[model samples]
Target chain A: MEGLNTVGLVEVLTLDGLDDVVRVLRDQGRKVIGPIVRDGVITHDEFDSVSELPHGWTEDQDGGRYRLVPTGTDEVFGFSSPSTSWKRYLYPERTLLIRARRDNGTVEVVQPQPDAPAVAFFGIRSCDLVALGILDRVFLDREATDPTYAARRSDVFIVAAACNRPGKTCFCASMDTGPTPRSGFDLSVRELHGDGRHEFLVEAGSERGTELLATIASRRATTADLDTAQALHGRAAASMGRRMDPQDPPLAALDPDHPRWDDVANRCLACGNCTMVCPTCFCNATEDSTNLTGTEAERWRVWDSCFSIDFSHLHGGSVRSTVKSRYRQWLLHKLVTWHDQFDVSGCVGCGRCITWCPVGIDLTAEITALATPQQSAGRKGVPS
Target chain B: MTPRMYEVVARRDDLPDTVTLTLAPVDEQCPTPAIGQFNMLWAFGIGEAPISLAGFENGHLIHTIRRVGAVTNSLAASTTGDQIGVRGPYGTGWDLTRAAGRDVLVVAGGLGLAPVRPIITELFANRSSYGRAVLLVGARTPDALLYRDELEQWRGRLDIEVEVTVDSATPSWRGDVGVVTRLVERAPIDPENTTAFVCGPEVMMRFAAVSVVDRGVPAAEVMLSLERNMHCAIGHCGHCQLGPEFICKDGPVVPWPRVKPLLRVAER
Candidate 1:
């Protein structure tokens, strides 16, 4: 508590002190959401106590696979990534825009009020923090802001957790997004376990974080603790299971008729799982519904994917009707055109699209395949 | 954003399936739309569709809609006094100032003609500001033509030239019968000073744009209005993306060079 007066002040806390951190946030009228074991997988949900956190649990994630395993050590905040990203909370799956009623001979329209609450996001990883910034660029920092996403994102507080144990599907080091929490959080915690000790190194990143840290019982962090945290982060960064060249090939230059697309299309189901789990894919469609009396109606915006045939529908028919075309759009939009649109790469190397893909379509492998030279003889009988 | 209320002042059947409606705001006035821009019209219990401004008459917005989907069908069924939700004057518009003191070539196919009606009207209103003006229109058949009376009236003018073409014709038809690109090939105009505005189906625009550029018109001087599935006309919805461009925000109207390569890619 003596070291909590300034930003960037490091403090040490016990496992019990971490529980008090959650208690203080809840006392300040913030809904606390963090990692919880639900449906046999680590996911995010609102919880009241630290006991709800997925302690001693980590996950094994590879292309097309995910399994939660207990590490036999009671180390909280040990998970690499959740099954879904924080976009589900900030940009919800569905939001109502307007409600209209037909009365007598005229129609009346009413704009729906946004349902937003002050939330404290606990255990958010560094890549997801970068994803939050990308979503902000798409929704808030634009010509016209999405009022619903703006309302939800305005009053949220972030408590980030450093990923000292990177997952097998993680490549955030290559994307330069994580392993250690660098910015965009009010408070950051690194779990230090081993040597018969279970403690956390907490740092204050904002004034509000300093005030909250002052209320809890903690001691100033020693140089040895800081060194241990740095060493662990360095080890995590060097041991990422996946790798991608940050300088990607210009995807637009690749031939649209490349045979690799056909090979991927044969395995791709267009099931849209990758879009749903992705933290930054922001396509949506509107749904209008009427009551039985036909007097009341509401328009709701729901999540949509480019892989769907109807995403490109026009007066005559769908534009990207073929599976090959849809897949190509998804790949090019994510890797190449996103820079033209947002001035940044759309992918943060979270690897959710690879793990969640039913057929294990690794994007990094696909990029390699597309970049490699192929023999012209193989293209003779390829289907368009 | 929520839509403002607009009441239908009048409706006319342009064809068996196409209806043109005159909409006037009930209270708050909607922003005036430029030639190539469009509005997201909401049919009370249905949904919204982006419809371009056909023209303006007296102060009301003229929208020519062909019944194709759920929202358009509901919009087409509305009577004179019915109220509907309307928003936007969204997307880029045709920059007429770019054509000052230049010959103008207008090419439209089928319902694509609706988006360019205002362009033709603006040209005639300031006839002295521009050089020779020609309009070429193409439809599937003789009976499918839009603005038949207006075309006849324009054909009578000696100051401007108007030509109509059909894919097929009956015995009584005497006009040109072929794809609209043929009109671009044989139109008597100096390509050095002509600015062309082309809009229609994607395939039609592709061919027409190529033909215009082939005739020595600069690709930068040729404009084409694009159509795509849109939800949030403000560009938050990602359905209208073509390559890196969001058709709803960056354009419904774009210069030819900007979209030529994108159009060449199948299903882009």
Candidate 2:
């Protein structure tokens, strides 16, 4: 393939020097956002300094629960992962497509105002990097190009941070999307605090990243730093708290009379919170509104979830009226049917769904409920 | 085609709860939609929903709409020559040419017959060229039957077989009293050389598919129109997704075997 531009790399700043990198990126007209400990969780936030980031913060999650606490080290980069993902950056909760105004007898549609500056997402995790790639496949496919997702994606530059600590809810190792990012990033960093010196193993994947790196001041990496980074990734890989069977069975492989879905649905609130935090969920609903003039009309698009009853509403009634049906659709689409439609699995196993759901519904547990039916007494002689 | 605002045309209480509206087309050709395609009809203030193309007798495209949703309720109450904007003819349509030499079995239930009527008209226009043509229709009541005038005209044809049944009947009625699938059982068909097309509610279509195939009609020879929520008439929006196929493009009209798996899945 013809290269857009040649790739280059430089070691200009330490891990703590990310503040200076953010400052430079901001001056270059990019929206810089990253993880910060807030409200007892590591969530996405705007930051301007190393102090603003979640320093030595780590998250613990079990089922539908998440908590953020300070790690016992002064090493600022100590964190497993954040609950809020990069999806909120690429696909916001809602966006306006048009706002209209009435002129004479005719209606004039006014396009939505220009977008904010392109973003340079900082401290992006490897699983999130894989998540972004998944979203790209869905939203940027030739048949259905989502302009809203595209606009946010194209302008953004990714700065992926290699994971040194794996979260308890994370199954990235099994999902093949974590511990280390293979591609789909501009720059990747491995922060190492060593004997009398703090350094980061920074690599540029793109020309823009190389140019930005050249502006920073730092020394070349010794063979030791490279080894350290590799070892850190290896440790993170082994430290993964969860694992899932990557066996991609067809969704039609599911037994209709399994009786597990109904049991799971009883606990599901249908709040759609799991989908909201998931980096790969891209279902949307379109809304049309008229201005006060009543003549001019505008159309807007917002994120929609399959969990909602209204999402399946037809002429007279909803196709899937019950919570069981909605939950089944979500699981089947994510694991099985989405592969049929998009030629890719809909999830990266980033653990957002497990942590953010109001009822800590573990996808792995649900899959286990189906995969090993004989293990559970609930499956015996029960109707779906 | 891009969506645009449109004024409503005349809407009258043509049948008890049904409204017959003449939609003003936004495009030049009045969007010469194929037989099984549908349009996303919308009222100005109310919401928009998919409605089948019932008839195109005049310059005004005729739509037999039931007063169901907010959009249709508002449309039912519209006046003469009122304006309504329409977008579509979206989704796959019937392959009329492919079924040319075979016996045609057109099975429809209630409002489902409205979308199938156009193809029946197209076939009748060239009546001599095709083989035996039969229309088996079913409705909840005789009053709920669509296109009474057209059904009468079809019943009088020498070459066509017309059979209609209702789930229940009135005291004055003297016709088949059973489910629509029962009419399919009674219709004389050369199953080996016949093509059956069904359009109705999901349950009705499923039952009809069984009835058609049980009579010896090949599963592949049966056609069905599947319904799903559609946001963008083009396939860009994911709302109308039915398995791997987009109901907006791949179908509304899909062969029985092709969509059989999706029929069993609840949320699709």
Candidate 3:
């Protein structure tokens, strides 16, 4: 209860002040990772320099399209969120589980090394934060707490920046993931503009964030600054170009034979780009590794996607052979059934699936297409 | 010093296409496994597969496997003295203590027999502790029934009722010819004093649960072993998740009432 009510706030930072914050976090031995402009698209990658940050950049996205363009402002946090997220730092692409050696007609079992990296993930959005919370239901629940995920998660701190600008594919408002996060972050910042000056309003949500904020050179927030922060959030909400049906049973509308799935399957590449960029998708596959000596071998687990044909393979054949079935499974599991299974909706409404998809397979559009007649007639064909 | 891995000492081609392998712990003292639990058996160079204990608890561990996947096909190809690694007898198992003093109904359909067989053996070993024991087994055909010779021995015992059936049958075979649920309909069970455990295909268990519940058995009194794609026996892997309950943890043995909602969904 103490964690819920204790909202901490502070003086806003200008665009130029971001480098100082990164320096302070890195000086504390944290690996700072964020969206960096690469090959024309803003993507998540390791960063040590403020120059690598996507400054004066904006993304254009629609069903089956994504593009990076120059924004008129020099503000580093002025742009909308990226298509990728911070889940990669918690659950990597691959990691070893066990190693074994056979000698003298006997075998030995060995445990793999644990991750101990302290991470400071910058530019995390509210939807991505909610996605992490849904994942926490799986990886950190009482029955099966993933040690690898837990180790990385506990050592990390989040520096979530609120959405000042939303892309065409953005829909965090409908999902309530937001223009602002309710919980699951150490710190959140809302960028504000006042009389030709840009400033970031800061709020600490956890003790780790409180400690990190203590090192930052900032005074406490005034009532007027709070009003400015609220006004900034309202502007972001008004600018939202995408919205999902807040009332629609979150991803549950996707049926195996849903006509909407057939529509997307036609343009979809089955390249798994959507899942790769998704912050909450946690399906994985395993592999066995052998050392050069042939005497030592290790078992490894790696991220996998349901879009792959082999993801649901049975003995003689694959259960979901077509792109249609795979897409249906992905959407339904993320939205509807996940609620029944895990008591949480799988999607955080980050809009990354809509943005990064090469063919621009918009999830919100598909859901709208599948929306029941009563909802469609009343809600103007789109939930958002 | 390293932890010792178990090795397959002997392999017996038991029923048609089914092989029984004996595993001996590499260490002098083997970690004892529990009834209704399973091991992640890995072929030396291939991969791992989950297999239930067919014979063990008397010390010599045995696994009855049917050649199904890449790992299983390779495991079936192993010689009598081939070596492999064993991880766990993980997850919560059948609470045999809960079944004590009650008449127990142990139903198996095809390969489902392997997982619950050890529980039957344990039940028989402590025969007087329970009221009565019944085993109703159904396979695809006569040739597919596992533990045939053992079935005969259990049949002769006065303490247990053992019956076999097949969905389809050969001309020479003269056993009950119907689905396993048909056998359940004819059997007389005192639902108040009985606890039924069902394992097999989802359809078989679904039908069997209907029959058991019709006989006045409470939903909590009937248990089913679910089969899911369990890559990691540890609860961490989401592959085996069925609702909030991880099939690998909350159960591979769950009360019918607990899993009814999940079973309705197509994905699970």
- State which candidate has the highest DockQ: 1
TM-score quality measure for candidate 1:
0.96
Tens-place lDDT per residue, model 3, A304-371, is 88788776665555656788767777777777767776777787777888877887778787788776
lDDT of 2: 0.75
lDDT of each: 0.88, 0.75, 0.75
- Per-residue lDDT tens digits for candidate 3, residues B179-263, read 8877777665677888888988776887788787877778788999877666777655456556556677768888998887556
Query: Model 2: residues >4 Å from true position, as ranges?
Result: A1-12, A74-76, A100-116, A194-197, A248-252, A289-297, A374-384, B9-12, B26-32, B55-61, B233-246, B265-268
TM-score of each: 0.96, 0.90, 0.87
Pairs in steric clash, model 2 = A64-A360, B7-B83, B7-B84, B8-B82, B8-B83, B8-B84, B9-B82, B9-B83
Q: Return whichever of 1 and 2 wins on DockQ.
A: 1
Candidate 1 residues lying further than 4 Å off, grouped into runs, are A1-7, A375-384
lDDT by residue for model 1 (B1-268), tens = 7999999999999999999999999888788777789999999879999999998767688999999999999999988999978898899998899999999999999999999999989998999999989999999998999998998999999988888999999898989999999999988778989999998988889889989988888889999999999998987889999998999989999999998878877787
Q: Which lDDT tens digits does candidate 2 get at residues A255-327?
A: 6446787798899999998888888887888787776767766666788988888887887788888898788
- Shift in Å, residue A186, candidate 1: 0.6
For model 3 chain A, give the 10-residue run with minimal summed lDDT: A375-384
Residue A79 error, candidate 2, Å:
2.6
DockQ of 1: 0.60
> RMSDs, each prediction?
2.9, 3.9, 5.2
Judging by TM-score against the true structure, name the best candidate. 1
**What TM-score would chain A of each candidate receive against the reference chain A?**
0.94, 0.89, 0.89
